[model samples]
Target: MNGKVLLVEDDASIATVIRSALEDEGFAVDRCESIAARDRALASDRYDVMLTDVMLADGDGIASIDSVRAACPQMPLIVLSAQNTLDTAVRASDTGAFEYFPKPFDLDDLVRAVVQAGGSGDKRGEEAEAGDGLPLVGRSQAMQAVYRMITRVLRNDLTVLVLGESGTGKELVAEAIHQLGHRKSGPFVAVNAAAIPADLIESELFGHEKGAFTGAIAQAIGKFEQANGGTLFLDEIGDMPIEAQTRLLRALQSGRIRRVGGRQEIAVDVRIIAATNRDLKPMIAAGQFREDLYYRLNVVPIVLPPLRDRVEDIEALAKHFLGLAAREGLPERRIDRPALALLEQQPWRGNVRELQNAVYRLALMARDDVIDAGTVTAVLGDPAEAVMRGRDDALGAALAAWLGDNAPAHGTLYHRAVSAFERPLFEYALGQTGGNQLRAAKLLGINRNTLRKRLGELQINADSFARAE
Candidate 1:
């Protein structure tokens, strides 16, 4: 771990602090205030490790990293930068940097990375082939593909659409993209499309001018304005209102917006990433979703696998949750081999989120510190059987009854049955989302305007569903 260090940084204070910390660990430090000085130091000295900042006084550190690598092919290079974008992180990764640390980074992490860089040890997020910095937690091929896709989108601002079931961590993927992209230094604003009320979704996304509505007290910034120069993550985007979808599509195409009551158009620069659990094709066919908007958002689609598909990764995910539980002072705990095996065999209807909830519950409720099969069995109760039964008994019966009744019908009867089934389903979704047209639309995998039109056709009143108990 002890070796000679070359530090390339423009900031004098940061260099001195880093040098002092490295010196405390019995390593000789050669500090360079600029990339030019760095080249001289690298040529003259055979250092064990070299650290360079992305933004340097003379030239860009990232640009110089390639030359440094060529000169010192065997030497490990650590990149430090205040630029802190997904673009920087990915560039450093692509250049084969031993480590990439964003500015205001933890001093201890730097020391540990330095020691590891000087040595041949593998870090938590590193494998022989894949060298990601974030602890995404799964080592399965499913996750490897995910990592590759995420890394691909990190360098650019291409709109990304993350498709995954709930609790599969779609937002985390969005966050990773934002953190690794050129906009890393900018704000990352996230809004759940299904959580906002339909009436307010317009104003929420695009700020309203004062007196635009009865409640307009002052001019407020919307998600687009707030996320200027960064990324806007729209969770459950399939739920966005149809009317709002029109406005959003305009903004995405023109990169400009006009407030609710204001005439002045404001330009914005923001990356858009959207996620949804529901299938959207049927909604599009049903005239509840816009085909053009779907095409725009689906520019770069990444589908996250459900937990059941990658059973090999269950133990790692469970242990990660357990580790989190232990850190939160839930009394030290560990899952036994049998318990882990049992988890991998589960149906995992709720996917990773369900597993996390179950693991945390087991960690807290287990009689012994080491959780065994009995504890997992007792906690999960019936291995998601009840959930399957609930769905089969109700919906399965309904489907069976419809098929039996419609078997004699001729000439493509799917349309008739679908029409019969959709009315109640739409009503239920509207109720569940508390009549929030946007959320209900999202829940139905359609657009808000579509939901509103449907309501009028069916004469469904949403005001009573404003809140659900």
Candidate 2:
């Protein structure tokens, strides 16, 4: 059989787009527009693979997977959906789908999976072979630096502190560390400090006894316990509550944790991997974060440069994301030179995450064989016109507003707008500076003590900043 694929999608436009892409790749693409058509295709065809959307106009896509499996037991199936919840991804995996890509997936990932389907390390292959490294599609020097750090951390159990912008794949770096590290056998337990409610974070990190709180009906295991002997990825660690920070500091100091409602301390042997978009030194200086814990977690820091800083990787990354999207049944898509040039020109404030989103949007909306600059402009909305022309209809109005109103006619807009962007930068720089007030202030261009006052206002590193320089 010639790498046949069964694609079930309700949207004819999307299906047609996907078919063209796959056909170009030499796959005998079979499109089924509805559940009935899907059933008919399955009955008549023996496909090497199946790409199914999570929702069909006639019924549930998850339900259809079982039918596909019953029909083609050995076929590799990939589920494409907009749902991003862990439960949804887990359920798709549980149903025996080879992979579950959240909607807006890059097309490169899909193609890679197809290429690796019968080879070693395919998505559903054995645990030792199924490495979950970040789908960081690039070979640029910046990416090489990131890959080096990941490889280094994976060789052993080193406490890693990853610093990056919000959408720069900090969590992916942490997971890659786990997948590549000596402790790959253990579960990668991720806890987003900022996402958890302040009152519940402690209990979440350290399991509570049954009846510890109003909803505690059964004994619960905290993230520390779950990640025992594996990796504990604390995302947005800068946002961890002060009380929890104190507790976490003690836990890291002693390798033992006291459950929220229990008196006894349980020892855990977990490799800590923390990440944050914010700076920690300022938080430590302001006394919002514990100083002692900062040093403990800062053993090895991996800083991820934002997408704008590494513009060399745009074309490769965009094509990679587009390929993943197509395999997930969006539409077979290709970025023309003009579209790629426009992508390279954008100021990626949200970093790689934003670019992936834009490409996915373009793939869905673009109407022909190629995605040109017009399609990119339509989906990404022209930033220059949006910003410089003050066109409110432009999608990049915010960027335009910042550039036109604040940027002076001198150096680059980045240098001029650095102060306005100081919040995220200050938070990160201070953490990098280890909470020294005089040092943090000097780095940020304020007086040594003036930096201290701002840390207080932002509830950042007051103690670290207050330290003797």
Candidate 3:
């Protein structure tokens, strides 16, 4: 808080606000309007941190950072930009800025970042070569945080854990890290742990030697070896078997692995990027997922926001998918603004993957080059009905699975099913309302007394859903 700060921004209003906030926090602040002034200040005096806006009156702030870094290489740099795109985030990262705050950012968060930056030394590292075909796309504020997190890990091999609901493009995040990172030249290997049988997951990851098991006709290389000098993306990591988790943990810890039955430990030079749709914390508490392994993999957790949360990005994402479909031999199509509006209103329960599929379907089946709301409805059906259909399908499948697995006594089946359905429904309401009984009851469209009675019968601790501030 007592560190000297050099603030470079062209707009007097913004500069004043930032300078005043820093001064209030006990920081000595110097104001500058352009990159030239920023450079002059750097030469005249040493500042603990430099907070600069991207666009200046004379030249681009981020582009001129090389000169600033050369003059004061040890000083931590924090970038402020109104250009809140993924490209901008990557550029700030390339300059080795301590943090990048997109314009319209929280003032308190910026002050807090400055406080953290003051105590830190230089974070400048080798600049990551920017790639044109960036896999992930979204300029929304929610996506800015994700883009920043992605850039932070591009120059390093820190183990990353991508968490999101299914179809939220978790693999795309893994791909972006690999493609934009230093490992771009090497192979990018991905394995879905959930798709693979639990028995074969270990062999799939660490390989197996000849005669290791009944099916081992010859020695085979595993994903770790295949992705040597690059990245190994373990998708659906939450579904991996307990035994495989142990082996994975050992390999991650030691930087080496052994064949299923081999005596020699083969060294691997691979970056581990794991992703899962499941909440690992709950799994850890339930003793299903290993706590130690969770900690090892959660070093740099990147939580991808669900589609419902980033509705603003729906238009861009839909257009992106349409372009992809066109390149893949499907008929090109453009969605009109009205159609896009309809899309943004729908609760995309299945997230981006589902949207992509819907787009591809529209591209293939649209009557005209321009997709209208009627065309969308014709191809995808009414948005509300689609959501209900998805939920009904999922519920039917879940009920089928439950009945197949647990065939209760004839008289108790109805009671058991009602309890099963009501418990999760009430829990979801409570969770959404943060355990406020009145709010939860309103959310569920039920009486508070009825909710209380049901909670008592279900033995659910409503207080557990209330998050600590």
Query: Best-fitting candidate, measured by TM-score?
Result: 3
Candidate lDDT values, in order:
0.82, 0.76, 0.91
TM-score of 3: 0.83
Compared with the true structure, what per-residue lDDT tens digits does model 1 show for residues 1-469? 4999999887899989999999999889988888778888888889888888888778888776657766787788788876654455566666667777766778998999898888863222321122255545676656655765776676678999999999888998898888766677899999999999998998899999999999999997899999999999999999988989999999999999888888999999999999999888888997877889999999999999998778888988888899988888886788899999888777777889888888999998999989999998888766567557667777868877877744746765677677788788887897787778888888888888887897888887888678846
lDDT by residue for model 2 (1-469), tens:
2478888877777777777777777788888867788878889877777788888888888866567667777777777776543334544654556666665566777666654552322234222222443455555556655654554444456688999898998887787667645687888899999999999999999989988889999989999999998999999999999989999988998999988889898999999999999889988888888888888898999999898788878998899888888988899888889889888888777789988898888889999869999888888788676444443445366557767655566667666565566567677667767766667777778786666666666676555534365
lDDT of 1 at 237: 92
Candidate 2 lDDT for residue 421: 63
Candidate 1: where is the Cα deviation over 4 Å?
Answer: 1-68, 71-93, 96-135, 384-469
Summing lDDT over every window of 10 consecutive residues in candidate 1, give the lowest-scoring window: 122-131
Ranking by lDDT: 3, 1, 2
Candidate 3, residue 117: how far the Cα is off, in Å? 1.9
lDDT of 3 by residue, 1-469 (tens): 5889999988899888998999999999999998888888999998999999998889889888889988988899999999887888888888889999998889999999999999987766888867787888787888998998999899999999999999999999999888888999999999999999888888999899999999899999999999999999999999999999999999999999998989999999999999999988889998899999999999999999999999999999999999999999999889999999888867678899889998999899898999999988887778898778878989999988888866797799888789779999999999998999999999999899999999999899999999889
Determine the backbone clash count of candidate 1.
Answer: 9
> For model 2, what is the error of residue 344's alpha carbon versus the real structure, in angstroms, after optimal superposition?
0.6
